[model samples]
Every structure is written in C-alpha cells, then in structure tokens.
Target: MPGWALALPIALLTLIPVAAVIGAALSPQPEVWDHLIRHVLPRVTANTALLMLLVGLGVLCVGVPLAWLTALCVFPGQRFFAWALMLPLAFPAYVLAFVQMGLFEFAGPVQSRLRDWFGSSAWFPEIRGSLWGTVLVLTMAFYPYVYLLTRNAFVTQGRRALEAARMLGESAPRAFWRVSVPMARPWIVGGLALAWMETLADFGAVAVFNYDTFTTALYKAWFDLHNLGAAAQLAALLVLLVLVMAAAEQRSQRGRSYQVASSHCQPIVLRGWHRWVAFGACALVFAASFAIPIVQLVLWSLSTWREELEPRYWDFARNTVLLAVGTAFIATTLSLVLAGVRRRHADRITAWVVRLAVIGYAVPGVVLAVGVFIPIAWLDNLLIAWLRPLGFEGFQILKGSVATMLLALSARFLAVAYHASDSAMQRITRSQEETARTLGLGSWGLLRRLYLPLLRGGLLTAFLMVMVDVMKEMPITLMTRSFGWDTLAVRVFQLTTESMWENAAVPALAIVAVGLLPVVLIFQRAERIQGA
Candidate 1:
C-alpha cells in the first residue's frame, strides 16, 4: 500500500466527529431548539460577543506593549521577563480563574484583610462572577499567545523598519505606530484571532466565573439537559465560529511575508526613569499573571496538603498521569505515521489528509466529547444487538470506556504531536534517505536505523506536549470520562464549582508543574529562533 493511504483512517476519524455534530444539528430537534433559542441562544451569543471584544482588547493592551518593551528596549530583566511572561501559559486559564477568585473574592484573604483594616464599608470592587473578573482572568492567562508571536516578530525583524521611519524624520512614537506595528500586523492579528478562538472555546474558565458562552451552553445541553441533539447543535454552532476565526487567521497570514530577520539593528537603550518604567511594567504583569498566583497556589496547597493529599488525590493524580501518558503515546505514534506519510509522498492527498487529521486541535474538547461519544455509543449499541443472540444480554463496549476517552483526546492533541514530529522529520535530508535506499534498506530499516535517532527528541517533545495538554484538559474528560476516572483537571473543576478553591490548589499545582516543561521548551525554541 502507498504511504499516503495510512493517513486515510486518521483523517476519517477527525471528519466523523465533525460530521456527526453537523448532521445532528441539521436534524429536526424542535424541543431542543425551542429551549435553546428562547433561553440559551440569545444570552450565549451576547455573552460570547462581549467576551470576545473585551478579551481581544484586553490581550492586545496587555500583551503587545509588553512584547514591544521586552523586544525593542534594553530594560532591567528584559531577558528574564521575555520568558517569565509566558509562565502564565503553564497554568490553564481555569486554574488561573479560580486562583484569582481565591485571592480576590469577598471572603478571601485580600478582601478579608482589607475589610479588617479599612472597615466593612471600604469600597472594594467585586471581581468574582463579574465581567471585570472574567476578562482579567482570561487576559492574564491568554496574553502569552499574543506576546510570544509579536515578540518573536520584533526580535527577528528588530528596528530595521523603525530605523527607516526614523530616517524619514518620523517621531519615534509615530515611527513605531506606522512601521513596527504594521510590519507585525499579521503576527499581531493572527495572535489576536488565536486568543479569541481560545476564548470562545473555553469552558472551564467561563464556567468557573459563571460566565455564559457557547462552550458552557454546549456543556449544559449535553450534561445538564441530557439532550444529545441540543449538544450536537451547539457544537455545530461552535464549529462554525471556529471556522470563521480560522478563516480570518488564514487571511492574515496570506499576504507578502513581513518577517525579516536582521541582527544589525540593535535594541533602543532606555535612560534612568524610562528604564525603571520598562522594568516596572514587565515586573507588574509578570507578578500579577504568574508569580503571584503561583505563590498563592503553593501556599494554599501547603496549607491543605495534609487532608487534600489523601488516597483519592493520588487517584486523581494517577488518572491524570495515565490519561496524559496514554494519549501522548497514541498521539505521538499516529502523528509520526502521518508525518512520515506526508514526508515520503509529498502529495496533495496525503497533505490534505494530514491537515484534516490535525485540525481536531482547534475543535473544542467538549465538541469532540459529544461527537466522539455519539458514534461510539451507536457502535456499542450495535454490538449489543449482535451479541444478544448469543446470550450476551448486557455487554457494552467503547461507550464511556478509557478507549473512547483516549480516542477523543488523541484527536484533540494529534496536531501537537504531528507538528513536533514533522518538524524533526524535516531536519532529515533527502540525501540521507537516498543513501539508505542505495544501501538496499527497506522503509522499516530506514525508519529504524536513520529516523529513530533523529526523531527521539521530537517524539519526546510531542509526548510531553500532549501529556501536559491532556493533564490540563477539562471539558472532554468531564463529559466523556468513565466512572471513577476523575483527573486532576476534573478535581479542580469540582472544587471550583463548589467554590472550594483552596482544596483545588494541590492538583492545580501538580498540573502546572507538568505544564511548565512545555513553557520552558517554548522559551528555548524562541531563543533558537532569535539566534537563527
């Protein structure tokens, strides 16, 4: 069989879930739509739009300036903040949401201390379950997506265009506004769209904050309402939103390449007050977003460790690790296969198939849970029908099983694994393959002898990346997990749902620890990109 054929199954797997969702949406669900359009749609659409607008502006305001300061100016701790700013990415947005609420809520320590000091009448702003709180939590958590891309664009392209604008007698501010910002528009806009997509797809953070969005609506449709049709319809709508956002992002990247790497242009040097201003700005963002929350989580964890570190906590940890490890291995192997097929064939069929297979990453996990569960449930029912004649009266398979969860998760994270594997695979020269062919080695032998060593780092990266993601994933597992399969992410969700943020801290901390590996790898890659 041709190598391209290998990806057909993988591609089909991705399509089935989306197809199932859309198909269910098309089917008449009068009762469901009556409930949704009346009670759900109006509120969800408004909240989603408002959330996007707020988050869009918030991320840009917080992220772009930080990127500019860290990239173009010589400021105190510029090097450290360059990477440290991304640390918030290590904590899932939901984790950050609860942590912030834990600290800032009316009954929490900060407010408690304030009420004690300044009397109960002291006007303190309420953050929990409010727009300000939701936007702030999401902005802090997601700004790294914007900062990473824009900072790289600045670091590589540097002040070359800025120099030209300066030569044209443009004011420094005007020069930056005209040259630098426009030049990095694609990255900035692309990053913004990406953040918006994440914001739109988010379930846990919004759920924690009691903010209504499509994701939360979808979750309610399936679990709360027990209406599969409604869930599928909601997922279908979300899929459309994702598609639109993707189109906008694609359009942003299509123009002439603005990415120009030149080392000659140096960073602008700041004088006394200006230097301190830059330092303070970076420090404040870093502290608020990452360091402070992390410290609070650790303290909370330490305080509650004796009780929260019980056997069930270990069970959650074990489940989290198993899910992460299982999904990572499956995703990595399949990704490596898809990557190999694309590399060896270089045909459109394979290329398109690979694209389809990897696109599951963009689809929200809750959508995947619904889409995946429906088809598998149908198959399980079919098996029961077939086995009934042989006295297998109640035999059920693939529904609410670990295999089902793994499949859904693998679909969701396959892209992460594929990108890592494909990148490493690209580093192998064609000449090496030709030489291996000349030596009469078959495909297996070539992969075993030549590609294995070269791919080790990439596969490990893929594994770790997928592992961390699975550890942090909430909606999918929450929706589809088998009985007693609760994970750390789920534990966090449970506690946050009950407003028990302190107890949720230990598990959140563990997940954050695992998540930090990828952030470190990301920073290392950014350094490499800058150097290159």
Candidate 2:
C-alpha cells in the first residue's frame, strides 16, 4: 500500500477520540456548567494551579541543582548519584504518596514515636492528604524528567558558554547563573513542561491526597455524578490548561540557539566543602525520593506478605503483564508503520497525519479515556442494534473488553514509539533507501530486509518504553477496564482507596519493580551519550 493510504486510516482512528472530546465539550450542558461554576470549578482551578506552581518550584529546586552537580562537578559518589538520582522515576507519585502517608500519618510510626517522647500532644506537621504532601511526592517522582534533560543540556551545550563567561572575569557561580542556565533554558523549559503536564494529568496521587484537582473533579463528575458530558467538559478545560503550558514552553524555546562551537569539554571538579555539600545535596534528594520510599515499600510488603500473596495477586500480575504486552506490541507496530510512511513518502498530508496521531500523548489520560469510552460505547450500541435484526445478541465487543483498553493505551502512548522509530529512521540516509529501491526491492521488501534489521534496537526501545508506561498507567485502566479485569495498578488503587496500605504495598512495589527496567535502560543510554 501507498504511504498516505496507510497513514490515513491510522490518523483517522487517532482523531476519533479527540473528535469525541471536542464534540462532548461543545454539547449543551447549562445546568452542569452552572453547578460546576458555582460549587466546583473555581476550587478545582485554584487547586490545580496551586499544585502546578508548587510542583514546578519543587522540581526546579531539586532537579536543577542535582543536574548541575552531577553533570558539571566531580564529587563523592558523583558517578553513582548520576544514575541513582533517576531511580525515583520507577516509583509513581501515587506509590510514594501512600508510602509517605503510611509512615508519617498522625497515627503512624513517626507521630506515634513523637507522641511517646512528649507524652502529650506535640506539634507534628501532618503529611497525609495535604496539598504540600502531594506537591512533595509528585516533585520527587517527576523531577527526574527535568534532571535528565537539564543534565544532558548542560553536558553537551553548556561548557562553552560557562567558560566564555569565566574568561570575561565572571565568578564561577555568576557564570553558572548568567551563562550556563540561560544556555540550557530551552531544555529546562521542555523538561518543566513535561513535569507540569504530568502533574496536571495525575489522578492517582491527587486522589490519594483528596486534593481536588481538575482530574479528580473530572472523575467525580463521571463516576459520582454519572455525568459523562460534564466529565468531558472538565477534561477539555484541563486540555486547555495543558495547551497553554505547551504554548508558553514553545515560546520560551523560540529564538534560542543551543549549538556550541566546540564539542570537547571537561567536567568541573569540586573541592573540599563544596564537594561534600554537592555530594550531600544529591544524596539527600536521591534518598528522599527513591531510597526511603522503596525501603518503606519493602518493609510493608514483608509485613503483609502472607495476606498479600494470594491467587489474586498472581491474577493481577498476569492481567497487568498481558495488558502491557498487548498495548506495547500494538502501539509499537502501528508507530513503526506510521513512521515508515513518513520517512518513505514525506508529504504535507503525511506529516500532518503523523502529527495528529501523536497528539494523543499530550492529552491527559482521563480525557483520552472519556473520549475513547463514550465513542466506543456508542459504537458498541450501534453494532448491537444493527446485529439484533439478524438475531445476534449481546454483541458488546468494544465497550468492556481488552480491546477498548488497548485502544486507549495506544492512543495515549503511540507517540513514544513513533518518536523512537522516527529518530532511528531519520538516521538512515536517503542513499540507503535509494540503493534498496535500485536493487529492485519494493516497499515491503525494503522494510523487511533493510528497515527492520536497522531498526531492531529502536523497536525494542520503543516497545520497552510503551510497556513500562502501560504498566504504570492508572487513570485510563481504572476508568475503562472490564469487570474482574484487575491489573496491578487497579489493585494498588483499590487497596490504597480502602486504606489498606500494607496490602497496597505489594502491587505498588511490583509496579515500581517492573518500571525500573525502562529507567535503567534510559540511564544506560544517557551514560553512553555522555561518554560519547
């Protein structure tokens, strides 16, 4: 098939959910809007804004300094902290939220010990179900996004700027502030945009804290109020916020050139107290973000091992693995096709189609879920009605099946695989394809013989990324899963919702464990890039 012919169907399929969302948002709902505006909308907007602000500040504070330290200065444990700092990416914010809440809630160990020491009511700050607690947990879980990008920016494009500033008689710190930071602004902004989007898209963590963000509001509207239209409207609003942030990020990157004249550079070496301070700072962030939460999870899992290790645990694991594997395979395969089309038959239409197909990644999971759910439910109903005339009964394939869930996952994560494959494809010179064509190889022949072999590693990376993301994904899974189709993420949410922290620990730990594969892979890739 021709490239545009292949790309058109994928683009249309990708746009269905987005079209559903836009249609829902445009549908009339004056009463719902009134109630939301009066009772919920303002509070939700304020809380979401506050949460974003807090998370942005927290990530910058933790991620920037750590990136600078690890990328620039050689200090004690620098090599270790370089990768160790990324370990927190394995733990989702929701997992960290529950772990911290379990360990430090009013009736938990820390407060109980403090109460014993005082023998009365002592001043102990609450860490559970609070806005600040949510911010802290999310920052720790997400700062890795900022850190990884910023460190790469610093290492690759920042040295020349810093050295030039130093030669101009600026002090090291001054040079870092005025030169290095500005030079790395585009990357930092990109990372911050990602972090902020994740924060807005988050449901599990904010739900755990009862923080009432837009996502929680959307969930409540759908499940509690039984109003899918209102939920979609809220989702649209969230998408608006995300678009605004994306615009701001692009504007920040505009007119910025990150190229450096020289490719060779040396990492700065710290001395004495400066080294110790940098080392301590990195250690503190890593421990607080990764080590402590993991240890707590391990302890909780040990205590609840007998109760947690039932047949259902295995069932949940199996379901999670199946869903993740299926989603990864479908997403990666479709992404490969779209990317190949773009590479082979580059045109305005193909480019636009590919762009539209990847936009789902920017849409929040809940939004995508609602958008996907409503349309699929409609289609299922229409099919049932059409089939009933032929004596066919109970034909509900799309409503509550693995297929629906996979569609949502694919919509949300196809961009990941697409970008990976596209990058790999771009690296293959046009001469290679021309040569293949000159050798009498058609599209399929070229793909099978040349592209597949060349893109093996990229395909694996794409598959792994999508698999890990699907494993960690919660909102869409929670919203769209069929009856009794519980994955580990759903199990963890269920247990956490019921305040079964110990039981939640098992599934949560399993998620973190599985999530570590991509983190380690990414870290290794970054290490190789840095070495080069």
Candidate 3:
C-alpha cells in the first residue's frame, strides 16, 4: 500500500476520540453545567491553579539549583549525582505518595516514634495527604524534566554568556543571574511547561492524596456522577488550559534564541568548600527524591512479602507486562510505518496528518479514556445489534476487553514511538533509498533489507520507551481494564485507595523497576548532550 494510504487509517483512528470529546463538550446537560459552575468548577479551578503554582515553585527551587550545580561546578560525587539525581524519574508520584503516607501518617513510624519519645499530645508536623505533601511528591518525581533540560542548556550555552558578563567586571553570582540565567530562560521555561503539563495530566497522585484537581474532577464527573457530558466538559476545559500553556510557552520563547555559537565550551569547575556545598545539596535532593522512597518501599515489601508476593501479585505483573509489551510492539510498528512514509513522501497533508495523530500524547489519560470508551461503547452496541440476527444473543466484543485497552494505550503512547522512530529515520540519508531503488527494490524490500537494519536501535528504543510509559500509566488503565485485567499499576491504585500501603509497595516497586529503563535512557541522553 502507498504511504498515504496507510497513514489515513491511523489518522482517522486518532481523531475519533478527539471528535467524541468535542461532541460531548458541545452536548452537555444544562443542569450538570449549572451545578458544576455554581459549586464544583470554582473550587476545582482554584485547587488546580494553586497546585500548579506550588509545584512550579517547588520544581524550580529544587531542579534549577541542582541543574546549575551539576552543569557548572565540580563537586564530590559529581559523576554519580549527574545520573542519580534523575533516578526519581523512575517513581510515579502516586507510589511516592503512598510510601510517604506509610512512613508519616498518624499511626505510621515517624509519628509513633515521636509519640514514644515525647507524649501522645506532643506536636509534630502533619505531612500526609495535604496540599504541601502532594506538591513535594510531585516535585520530587518531575523535577528531572527541568533538571535535564536546564542542565543541558547551562552546560552547552550558558558558559560563554557567563564569561562575557565576568569580563565586564561582574561578580560570579551577579554574572550568573544577569547573563547565564537570561540566556537559558527559554529552555528553563520549556522545561517548566513540560513539568506543568505533566502536573495537570496527573490523576493518581492527587487522587491518592484526596486532593481535588482537574483530573480527579474529570474522573469524578464520569465515574462517580455518571455524567459523561460533565466529564467531557471538564476535559475540554483541561484541554483549553493545556493549549493556553502551550501558547504562552511559545510566546515566552518568541523573539529569543538560546543557541550558543559553539557546543564545545568548557564548564566552570568549583573548588574547596564551594564544591562540598554543591555536592551536599545534590546529595540531599537525590536522597529525598529517589533513595529514601525506594528504601521505604523495600522495607515495606520485606515486611509484607508473604501477602504481596503471592500468585495474585504475579498475575498482576504478568498482565502489566503483557499490556506494556503488546502496546509497545503495536505502537512502534505503526510509528515506523508512519514515520517511514512521511520520510519517503514528504508533503503538507501527510505532515499535518502525522502531527494530528501525535497530539494524543498531550491529552490527559482520563480524558483519553473517556474519549476512547464512548466510541468503543457505541461500536459494541452496533456490533451486538448486527450479531443478534445471527443468533449470537447478548454478545459484546469491544467493551471491557483487552482490545479496547490496547486501542487506548496505542492512542496514548503513539507519539513517543513516532518521535523516536522519526529521529532515527532523519539520520538515514535519502541517497541510500535512491541506491536501493536503483537495484529495483520495492518499498517492502527496501524496509526489510535496508530500513530495518538501520532502524534496529531506534525501534528498540521506541519499544522500551513506550513499554516503560505503559507500565507506569495509571488513569487510562484504571478506567478501562476489564474484570481480571488488573495490572501492577491498577493493583497499586486499589491497594492505596484501601490504605493498604504495605501491600501496594510490591506493585509500586515493580512499576518503579520497569520505569527505571526509560530513566536510564534519559540519563544517558543527558550525558551525551553535555558531553557534546
């Protein structure tokens, strides 16, 4: 089939859910909107805005200083900190939330120990399930997004700018603030935009904390209220917020360029106590973000081994692996085809279609779940009606099936696979394709003998990236999974909701272990960026 022919189906599949979302938004019930606006909308909007503000401040406070230290200064354990700081990326915010609650709740170890030392009436800070706690956990998990981008910016570009300021008699700190930071603002803002988008899309973490945000509000509207139209309207509002953020980010970046004249500039190196200070700060952030939570999880897992490591746990793991592997394979294959087609036949329509398909990544998982479910429910009804005349009464195919789950997962993660494959394809010169065509090789032959060989690394990278993301995905799986379709993520959510943090630890650890793959990849990529 021609490249465009293959892309057309993928584009249509991608757009169906989006169309459903729009349809739902347009057709909301009058009563639901009236109630939502009077009571729910204002509160949800305030909480979401406040959460975003706090998270943004928290990420900057932690991520920016660490990025500056790692990029510009020599320190004790600098090499280790460079990668270790990113290990928190392996943790989902919800997992950390449960772990922190386990360690700090009223009956948990910290408070118990405090009561042991002092009186039961003694004062201790309340840390679990609060807005501050949620902000802390989310910042720990997502600061890497800012750190990675900002560190790369500082290392590759800020050094020259900083030097120019120093030559004009500015002090070191003054030069950093006046020159290096301004030059790196674009990248820093871009990183913050990514962090905020992830924050807005998050459901599991906020849900666990019992903090009402837009994601949780959307979930409640759909599942709790059973108001699909209200859910869709909420989702539309969330999408509009995301679009505004994207536009603001673009506008902030307008008329400014951060690229340096060269990528080979030497970074600054600290000495003596300055180095130790940098080292201690990075170490503290790493310990709080990654090491501490993981250790707590391990301790909890060991205590609950008999219960958590049973056959049921294995089943959840198996289901998770199956879904993740299946989604990765299918998504990567489709990405390869779409990217290859675009490469071979570059045109405006194909480019626009590809862009439209990849936009699914920006949609929140809960919104995507609702969008996907609406169509699948409709299609299942149509199928059952057709099948009833053939004597297959009460037959249902799409709803509550792994097929629907895969469809949702593919729509959610296809952008990851596509970008990875597209990057790989761009590196393969067109002359190679010309050379293959001269040998009378057709498209399939070209793919088999040439493209596959060249794309092997990229395909695997895309697969692993998608697999890791799928393993940690929460809202989509939680909303869509059938009976007996529990994955590790869903198991974590179930246990956490029940306040069974010890039992949740096993699956949460499994998710973190799987998530480590992409974190390692990210670390390696950051190292390469700096080393360049």
| Number of the predicted model whose TM-score against the real structure is largest | 1
Local accuracy of candidate 3 as per-residue lDDT tens digits, 2-82? 656668788766688878887877888899899889978999999999999999998888888888777777778888887
Estimate, for each residue in 66-172, the C-alpha lDDT of model 2 and write its tens digit. 88888888999999998999998898888988887887787778788878889754577666558888998999989999999998888887356677777899987
Model 2 accuracy (lDDT, Cα): 0.87
lDDT value for model 1: 0.89
Provide the TM-score for each candidate, comma-separated: 0.97, 0.96, 0.96
lDDT by candidate, in order shown: 0.89, 0.87, 0.85
Candidate 1 TM-score versus the reference = 0.97
lDDT (Cα, tens digit) per residue for candidate 1, span 178-214:
8877888888997898799789879999998898889
Question: How well does candidate 3 score on lDDT at residue 357?
Answer: 79
| Alpha-carbon runs more than 4 Å astray in model 2 | 1-5, 120-122, 389-396
Q: Sorted on lDDT, highest at the top, how do the candidates line up?
A: 1, 2, 3
Instruction: Determine which window of 10 residues in candidate 2 has minimal summed lDDT.
Output: 256-265
Best by lDDT: 1
